[model samples]
Target chain A: MSEMKWGWPVIGAALFLLSAFIPLIADGYWMSIAVTIAMYTALATSWALFSGPTHYISLASGAFFGIGGYLVATAMSDYDLSFWLMLVVAPLVSALVAALIGFATLRLSGVYFVIFTLGLAEMIRNLVSWVQNNFLGSRGLYVLTDFTEAHIYWMLLVVCLVIFVFGWWLSRSRLGFALKIIGNDEEVAKHVGINTALAKVLVFTTTGFFGALVGVIIAPRYSYIEPNQVFSPELSFMVVIMALLGGAHRLWGPLVGVIPFALVWETITIAFPNSTTFFLGLAFLFIVYFIPHGFAGLIEKHWLRLRS
Target chain B: MDILVSGFLLAGTYALIAMGLNLQYGVARIMNLANGEMIVLGALAAFWAFTSYQISPLLTLFLAAPLSFIGNWLIYKFLLRPLVKRAKNQGQLEVDSILATFGISFALVGIMVSIHGEYFTYSFLANPIEVLGSTVAENRLVAFFIALAIGLVLYLWLNHTRAGTSVRAVAVNADSARLVGINVDKVSALTFALGGAIATVGGVLISTFITLDASIGVIFTMKALIIVIMGGVGDIRGAIIAALILGIVETGVATLVDPGLTLVAAYFIFLLVLLFRPQGLFGRRST
Candidate 1:
C-alpha cells in the first residue's frame, strides 16, 4: 500500500493506544462513559463499512450483536469454554447467518429490504425469547466476568482501530470501487460485469462479523444477558442514526457521528430516561431533514469551498 | 371448524389493518412505518373514552376518523411534504420516508408510554355470541362486522368514485396522472390521510378484542407489512384474502401447536412467500 493509504490507520492506531491510558487518569464513571463511546465508535464504523458504500441501510446489526452476546452467555453459563474461544465462534456464526439472510433478502428493492431487515431482527428476538421461555426454563443467561470497564474500553478501542485500518484498505481496494459503482447504480455496476449480489453479501457478512465481535467484547458488562436486552431494535436504529449522522459515505464518518451522539445520548439517558426513544426519533428526523449526508459531508463541503 | 370460523373473524380486523397500509404504500407511495402507531393511538383513544365515559367503541370510531384524518393531513402537509419536494427519485423518497416514519413511530410510542405505560384492557361487550354453532365473543363479532363495513366502503370508494379513481391513477403512474392534470401532490396527501383514518378505525375495532399496550404497535406493524406484501402492494382484494390466510395460519398454529409460536409461524410464512412469490399471491410480476 502507498504512504497515503497507510497514514490514517497508523495515526488512528496511535490514538487508540494513547486512549488506553484513560483508566489510570480518570475515575470509574468517566471510564464507563469512555467505554460506551468506544463501543459505539466500533459499531458505527463497522456498520458504515457496508451500509455507507452500498446504501442498504441494514437494521440487522442488533441481531448479529445479540447473537454474539447469546453465544458468550450460553457458553459461559452452560459449558466450561474460554471467553476467547467464544469470541471467535460468535462472529463466525453471526457472519454465516448474515450471509444466509443477505442471499435470501437482498433481491428486494430499497423499502422492502429495509423493512425485511427490521422484521428479521424482530423475528430472531421472538424466536430467541420463545426458545428460552420453553426449553431453557429461564428468561436469560448469566455471563460473569472480572473485566473492568477500562478493560472493555481498551478492547473496544483496539477493535475500532482495526476496523478503521481495514476500512482504510477497503476504500482503496477493487471491491470498494465496485461497491461505489453499485451504490451509484446497481444496473450500471451489473452492466460493467460486477457481481453486485456477491459484493453486497460479502460486505454484509463482514459487518455481521464485526457486529457480533463488538457484542462479545461488551457481553461481560451486562452480567446477565436477556434476548430483549441484547436484541433491542432501538440499538439497531441508534447505530444507523449515528452512522448516517456522521456520514456513512466516509470511512471515518461513523466515528465523527458516534462521538457527539454518544455524549448527547448519555445526557438524554440521564435527563429523561423514559423519553430516550422519543429523543431518538427526533434525532432521526433532524438528521434526515437537515443533514442527510452527516457531519462528514458538511466538513467536506466547507473544506472543498475553502480550497476552491 | 371453530378455529376456521375464529380465524375468519380475526381476518376481518387484519384486513382492515392491511388495507390501510396498502392504500398508503400503493397510492401515496409512502410506506408509513408509523402506521401501527396510528392503530395503537386509536385503540388508546377508544380505551380512554370507553373507560372514562362509558362511550361505545362504535361511537369512538366516529370520533377517531375525522381527528386522525386532520392530524395525518397536517403531518403530510408539513413534515413529509418537504421530503416529497426534495427527493430526486422514488428510491430517495422511500429511504427518507422510511427513516422519517420510523422516527415518528418511536416518538409516538414514547409519548404513549409517558402518558400511559400500563397494559390496558376493558370489559366491553364481553358476552358470548353464537357464530355458526361455536360461540365467539360478542366483542370480536362486533369488531368483525365493523371491519367488514369499513372494508366494503373502502372497496366501493376505490372502485366507483372519481376521486378514488384518480388516487388509483397516481398509484399506477404519477407522472402520467400529472400529465392528465391530476394534482399528484394533493392526491397523495389525501390518500395518506385517508389511510391513517382507516388504520385508526381498524385500531378502534380491534381494541375491542385485543389487549393493548404502547409498545405492541411494532407487532401490528410487522403483521400489517406481512399481509400487505403477501396480498401485493396495491391490491385490495388480494389484501383481504392474504389477511384471511394469515389469520387462519396464526390461529391454527396457536390452537394446534404452541400459542407462542404464532408469531414465529407468521414470520415463517412471510419468508416462504417472499422467497417464492415476491410479487404476491395474486399479483402479476411487474415489468
Candidate 2:
C-alpha cells in the first residue's frame, strides 16, 4: 500500500524528468514531435481545467490562441517588442478578453454555451481578418525570430509543467471541490454557499490565459502567422477532443490522451498528408461509440469493478 | 437601395436552413452541428447528378433530397437514439451529442471531400434579373422563390399537419406526448427527416448562388446555427425573420462596407444576441 502511494508518483516524476532531457538526445525531427506532444498536453489540460470541472464545453481556445499569435505578431512588427515581453503581455490580454466575455457567457449552460464559445472564436477570426485587410496591409505577419526548435521545446516543457502542476494543486484545493460540486449541480453549489458565478468566471479566465499563452510561445517558433490558420475551429476541436479522450475529469487524463494521439497524428500527416483530418474525424467517431469515458474513464470503470 | 433589395433577396434563400436548424435543435433537442454538412450532401449529390447525367440542379432534387433524408434518419435512429437512451440527463445528452455530431461532421466531411476532391467546385448558370430596380442573378431569384416556398410549406405544415403537430407535441414534452399515445419515435424521425430535407434544399439552392466545395459545410452550419439562435430556437416565424435579418446584415455589410467585414458584422450580431438575449428575438422569454 505504501509503495503504491509513493512508488507510482516517484516513477511518474522520474519519467517526466527523463523526457525533459530528450531534446538533448533527440534530433530535430523527433524534437518537433516532442514539441507537438507538449503543446497539445498543455492545451488539452487547460481545456479540462475549465470544461471538465464546469462541464461548459468551450470552443474558445482557437480564439484566445489566435489573439495571442496576432498580439505577438503585431507587437514584434509594429513596436519591435521582445518575445519575452510579448509572452508576459499575451496571457494578460487574453485573460482580460476572457473576463470581459465570461461575465455574460457564464450565465449560459449546455449547448447554448458551446455555441456562444464557438461563435466568439469565429467573431474574433473575422475581426482579425478585417484588421489584416485594413491595418496590417498583409494577410499574415512574418517574424524573423532566431529561436531554435530546442528553445521552443524547453518553453513548451515549462508551459506543460506549469499547467499540470496548477491542475494537480487545483484538484486538491477547496476550489477544486467547489468546481466539482458545480459541475455536478450548479444549484446545489449555490445552495452550499459557493459563489458559483464568480468561480466559473475566474477559472474560465485562467483557461483562456493559458490557451492564449500557447499562441504567444508558438508564434516565434514558426516563420509566419496568419489569422485564418491560427483561429481555426479545427484547433479548438482537437484540444477539446484530446481532453475528452484522455478523460477530462482528472488532471493527468489529458497527458494520457494527447501523447499517443499526437504521435499518431504526426505519423499520419507525414505518411498521408491531406488524409489526416479524415483519420482524425474517424478517430473521434470511434471514441464516442466504444469509449465515451476516454482512456482514464475506461480504467476507472474497470478498476472499481475489479476491486468490488 | 440595390444592396438592400439584394440582401433581402438573399435572405429569402437562407430562411430554409435556419428553419431546419430550429426544428432540429428547438424541437428535437439534437444540436446537429452537421447542419452544414447535411446541406452539402444535397449540393454534392445535385452537382454530381447534374454533371454526370444532363440534368438541371433543380431537377436533381429528386435524387439529392431523399438520399440526404434517409442518411439523416439513419443517424438519428442508429447513432443518436441509443446514446440518448443511455445518458443520465439532458445536460449530459447535450454535451455528448455535440461531440458525437462533431465526430460525424469530420467523418462525413472527410468522405465528401475525398470523393469530390476538396478543391472541386461548380456554379449554376443564370442571367441577371431586375427586381425592384436592382439587378440580381437569375438563379438567386429562383433560389429565393424556392426557399420561400419551402418556408411557407413548413410553416403551414407545422401549424396544421398531423405529423408537424405530433412533432410539436414531442418537442413540447416527450413524456406527455408519449403518454398521449404519440409515436415518439415516429415524430422524432419525422422531425429529423424534415430538418434534413429543408437543409438539403438550402444547400442545393445556396450552391447555385456561389461556388461551393466540400468544406463549405461548416460555414453553412455556423450561419444556420447563429440564425437559429437569433430567431429563438423553436419559433418558425422567428427563424424566418432572423434568417432575413442575418441575410440582410451579411449582404448589406458585404455591399455597403468592405467585403471582408461581412462575416465580422454577422459574428458581432451573434455575440450581441448571445450576450443580451439568448432566448432570441422571437423566442418565448426563458425563465
Maximum-lDDT candidate: 1
Judged by DockQ cut-offs, the docking class of candidate 2 is medium
Scored by TM-score, the top model is 1
Q: Across residues B1-287, which tens digit of lDDT does each residue of candidate 1 receive?
A: 88898899999999998998998898888889999999999999999999899999999999999999999999889989899899897778888899899888989999999988987688889898898998889999989988999899888998899988899999999999999999999999999999999889988988898889998888888889999998999988888999999999999988897776777888887888878888988989876
Candidate 2 regions exceeding 4 Å error are A1-12, A119-122, A305-308, B118-125
Write down the lDDT that model 1 would get: 0.88
How many residue pairs clash in model 1? 0
Global lDDT of each model? 0.88, 0.82
The ten-residue window of minimal lDDT in model 1 chain A covers A104-113
Which candidate leads in DockQ? 1
In order of the candidates, what TM-score does chain B achieve?
A: 0.98, 0.95
Residue pairs of candidate 1 with colliding backbone atoms: none
